[model samples]
Target: MEFREDILGAPYEAAELTLRPDDEGAVCATLVRRLVPGSERAVLYVHGYNDYFFQTNLADHYTALGFSFYALDLRKYGRSLRPHQSPNFVRHLAEYDEEIDEAVRIIRELDGHRQLLLNGHSTGGLIAALWAGRRAGRAVVDGLFLNSPFLSMPAGPAVRTVGGPAVTAIGRMAPTRVLPSSLNPHYTHSLHKDHQGEWDFDLTLKPAEGFPLYAGWLAAIHQGHRRLRSGLGIDVPVLLMASTRSISTTVWNEGLRRADAVLRADDIAAQGPRLGRHVTIVRIEDGIHDLVLSGEAARTRVFAELDHWLAAYLDVPAIEAPLIDAPLIDARPADARPAGESA
Candidate 1:
């Protein structure tokens, strides 16, 4: 793996790792880094569906709090996508173990970071939680941080109950069959600069309409959710953050900018405790699906809550100036069950 200046430019570098290929052909994953020299702690960020590591400000925030930051674009994603491969397609979520394991090796063995935090967003968050659970009782990761994890289907539980089996059956027979996408463009509109937002990222990497969702991929996600509902026994402190409200709609509206337009926030909050014995849930009012991409006021509150939580639970020193002066929206411990019940 050779690291070179990334598309994001100076201070940011990306390295590509070759992985064992599946039926679709050659595979690779990209690890992007912004190292803070001599820092002993690091953060490994995983992007959600139709997303990549383009959040420079997020890296900066971690670096400010004394950590080397790294983000992974899993196989067939952003920097790793090749013409021969399907976009973000995996028959089983465990297929990501190849690159995530490599990334951990590089961060801990090569870079020599002693403490590592696993940070993930949306679908990536689900992957991270399950991955951590699989690594339970091992000291691979120090903590887990999830930003709006896709713990439950946005269409609600009934659809998942009835459709999961059908999707899995179709996936087993024809894994490559594409399903109609349910992604709304308004969420993209709320984030991209060309639209109504302030951030500018490569649209090709994270298209407004998103790529096709395969039956196999959806089936894999359903399986992951099932595993979460049954409990994963993740043995680490966890921090789960999301907006207080969810707004699911296809049409563009001002509310899309301030609320979660993807997964349901209530479902996320309800499912978060199932992750581990020690989990903290925080709800940010007026925040979008990605708390980091929320408006200024809400974003500040999100960061403030994060900073305080890190200092309180993970032993990280708090910043001198708090990001927000308002009362925190919510901070509660999850009553974890040995085995979780169905949603």
Candidate 2:
């Protein structure tokens, strides 16, 4: 494994891991690392669907808390995307086990880090939880941190119960067939600096329209959700963080800037406890789907809560507070809304 400067540039580096080719062609995974010499603890992060490791501030936060940070761009996603491969396509969620296994091996055996934390966001959270459950007796993971894990279908029960089986059945016959998608561009708009948010990233990598949703991929996600619901039995301590509220909308609205426009926070909170016996759920008021990328105040609250949990559970020191550069546009008064509208 050779390390090179990451796409994000200085102080960040990535190592590529070539894996067996799938039907699509050659595929690989990239492990992005930010290390401080002599740090005994490390955190391995996994990104969600249509996402990559562009949150440098998150790495800085973990570094401040005395932990080395690493993120995995799973095969066909982000840095691992090959020209011949379909973006983010996989027939089984377990297909990721190879990459996760390699990442853990490098962190534990090669890097010599004694305590390792598994951090995952959205779909990544579901993947990590399932892996931890599978590896419970092995004692490889010290703890688990989930950011708005996709516990269930965002659609209500009717769709999940009725449409889920139909989707899976079609997926079995034609795994690569694209399915109709309803993802709104508003969430992407809320996170990009060019649109309405503070951070900037490659729109091509995580486009507003997003990559096509394939039947097989959706089926894999459904299977993972089923496994999670049945009980993961993950022995490690788990911290699940999410926005306090979820607002569904097809049109642009100020509420989309403050609340989670992606997954329902209630679904996450409800299913969080089932992941393990020792699961702690924290809801951040006015935070977005990705808590780390929320507005200044909410983001700060997320870090503070995470720091507190780490201190209590892992005996880690408190993180020295840093001045936030992003403006808290979402921290407006409760009654605040665009003008000319009457409630």
Return the clash pairs for model 1, or none: none
lDDT of 2 by residue, 1-343 (tens): 8999998987899999999899988889999999978999999999999998898999999997778999999999999998898889999998998999999999989998999999999999998998999899898999999998888889878999998888889889999999998788989998999998788999999998899999999999998988988999999899999887888888888898788898988778878878999998887877999899998888888888898789878889866674334433232222344775432
Best prediction by lDDT = 1
lDDT of candidate 2 vs native? Answer: 0.88
Give a tens-digit lDDT track for model 1, residues 16-107. Answer: 89999899888999999999999999999999999998988888899999999999999998999999988999999999988999999999
TM-score of each: 0.95, 0.93
Worst 10 residues of 1 by lDDT: 330-339
